[model samples]
Target: MRLRPHHLLCTQGYSGKGYSEAFVKNMDAVVHRLRTEDKTPIELVFSTDDLCSCCPDMLDTDLCRENEKVKLFDRKTAEYFGLEEKTYIYQKLASYIRRHITPDMLADICHGCSWYPASACREKITGIK
Candidate 1:
């Protein structure tokens, strides 16, 4: 499964509450698969991914209705983690997130996201051990 840079953070616990039920379900399934399937190599993608595939906002095969905003988030996340699109294991991304992305940066990175207010990602990121 491929994932956007920000999704490495988003999937830690963010609930797709405001999005479609199918989108939320797909996100949950992806997260579960990432957490359990050791064989699944989750590539770090700069564009649309498995999670975005289920979103209603996806415009084309690899585009989003809010493409500009999405790109901004993706760039910010990639820059923060010093990552480029490449094949990566889920554990490696999670480890980078825990070792580098601090609480203060979390606030800035997530401030533009609508889900940040109610999403469990804040607690999940802080509680990473």
Candidate 2:
């Protein structure tokens, strides 16, 4: 599965909501697969990925409407997690995130995301209210 760096965080925080029904359905399937198949190989990229394939914001050119903001999120996530554009086992990556990511770090990494405010991502990832 191809995913953007920040999408690792998104998958963890997913709560059956998205821009559209299609997007939600797709996200649910992807998240389920990752959860059920811990050894699933995920190739992290900086560009549009599997999750973005069905996103409403995705353009025909394969860029998102919020491309710049998305890029910033990706950069921050990669930097904070010491991640690289490479294949990783979903379980290992998820474990690393769960072990190391803090609420303050999540806030910094996801600062401009529109879904951050409304989503329970912080609580889900950091176990903090």
Candidate 3:
């Protein structure tokens, strides 16, 4: 599964809400697959990814309307996690993130995301060991 870096957090924080019904449905499926298939290989990309494929904001040119903002989020996430554009085992990556992430780090990486403020990501990430 291909995903943008910030999507690592987005997937964890997903709560059945989205820009549109199609986006929500797709997110549910993606999140479900990631949860159920721990061995799934996730390829981190800096560009629009599987989740973005269904996003309403994605234009026909495949760029998001809010591309610059999301790109910054991706960069910050990658920097914070020392992540590279490579494949990782879903379970291992998720575990690594949960084990090392702190609320302060999350706040720094996801500061401007529209979803960050309302999502349970901070609570969920902090709750994990």
Candidate with the greatest lDDT versus the true structure:
2
Task: Spell out the clash pairs found in candidate 2.
Answer: none
Assess candidate 2 and give its lDDT. Answer: 0.90
Local distance difference test, per candidate?
0.80, 0.90, 0.86
**Each prediction's TM-score against the native?**
0.88, 0.95, 0.93
lDDT tens per residue, model 1, 44-125 = 8888998888899998876899888778888888888888888888876787787777877887777678877767887788
Q: After superposition, how far is residue 99 of candidate 3 from its true place, in Å?
A: 0.9
lDDT per residue (tens digit) for residues 1-129 in model 3: 899988998888787889999999999999999888859898988899999999889984438898888888899889888999899987788889889888888888888888777888888776732
Best model per TM-score: 2
RMSD of each: 2.2, 1.0, 1.9
Distance (Å) between predicted and true CA of 115, model 2?
1.3
Residue-level lDDT of model 2, residues 8-124, one tens digit each, is: 999989888899999999999999998888599999888999999999999955489988898899999999889998999978898899899999999999998888999989988
**Which is superior by lDDT, 1 or 2?**
2
Model with the higher TM-score, candidate 2 or 3? 2
lDDT of 1: 0.80
The parts of candidate 1 lying over 4 Å away from their true place are: 15-18
RMSD of 1: 2.2
Worst 10 residues of 2 by lDDT: 60-69
